[model samples]
Target: MRHKCRIAQLGLPADQRKALLRNLTTELIRHGQITISQARAKALRKEVERIITLAKDGSLASRRQALGYVYDKKLVHVLFAQAPERYGNRNGGYTRIIRTVNRRGDNAKMAVIELV
Candidate 1:
């Protein structure tokens, strides 16, 4: 049984997966939207939501923590500065994934992940 093995390997080695996620997270935050595979979107949703949650706190430590995962310092600043105010009235569910057409070649499932 695959009990408690929660992390999605994403069919990549550990370092590569981490790098991919970090890049995706930065793009999502900077652009407020991204289109990718369904599996990647699902995995990224968890990460982005967690980062937004940290941003909601607006603490120094939280900012540092988010900075660690996110590559751009300016993006992290934007996240901590704007995200809290934007999402202050709400509880959670910062992002949404909308199903979209599959790729032409591989026919892979696709989705648009956007910040809500």
Candidate 2:
């Protein structure tokens, strides 16, 4: 019935999807904000939030865990360095997604996901 399945496949195979999300995570950490397809932004939110949560922990294990998803060592270092200071007082909701205009090529709904 397709019920209770929450992970969006994004029409890509496992490896490609993982790679896409990893790159997206790295970029978002590096740039502090990024524009992407609405569906991907929605799907990426969960992982991004989780990574931030891990970063908030500010532990070696948490850093390792974030590194697993965010491939770039430098970006991962930045994430760990900034996450706690940025979000230490807050509980969650570290990122905000704002809807934007349709993409010109495919008319896909676009959104900007930025660190809050």
Candidate 3:
């Protein structure tokens, strides 16, 4: 029956999807860039944008919420504490997707997701 179900499965169950997004969010925030498939990059872009929108405020609640996903206090520190100042005045579109050559073996499309 699987009708009108539009949520992306991401080839993972709920808990695993949360964990996967959490880890991806952390690395993207910390390193400023990560490489992956187009589907994941798009999905992860949403999560990263959500957190960054919250970060623009620099409030305790936003910090806590970001921490809920980010997990690492240090990363949260850099995310909310520093990023706001750096990205202040900007009104969203905080990430970028740079396409790359296909992966050697699997021949999968590769993309570099980075924070702007």
Best by TM-score: 1
Off by over 4 Å in 1: none
Candidate 1: C-alpha lDDT: 0.94
Any idea what lDDT model 2 has? Answer: 0.89
lDDT of 1 by residue, 15-106 (tens): 99999999999999999999999999999998999999999998899999999999999999988889867999988889999999999999
The alpha-carbon deviation from the true structure for residue 84 of candidate 2, after best TM-score superposition, in angstroms, is: 1.4
Write candidate 3's Cα lDDT for 4-107 as tens digits: 98667789999999899989988898899999987789889989999999888899999899888897888888777777787897888999999999989999
lDDT accuracy of residue 49 in candidate 2: 90
Clashing pairs in 1: none
Candidate rank order under TM-score: 1, 2, 3
Q: Please, what is the whole-model Cα lDDT of each candidate in the order they appear?
A: 0.94, 0.89, 0.88
Residue 16, candidate 3: C-alpha displacement in angstroms? 0.9
Worst 10 residues of 3 by lDDT: 77-86
> What's the C-alpha lDDT at position 57 in model 3?
89
Tens-place lDDT per residue, model 2, 1-116, is: 88998788999998999899988988888888999999999988888899999989989998888878887888888778887788999988888999999999999999999989
Listed in order, each prediction's TM-score against the native is 0.95, 0.92, 0.91
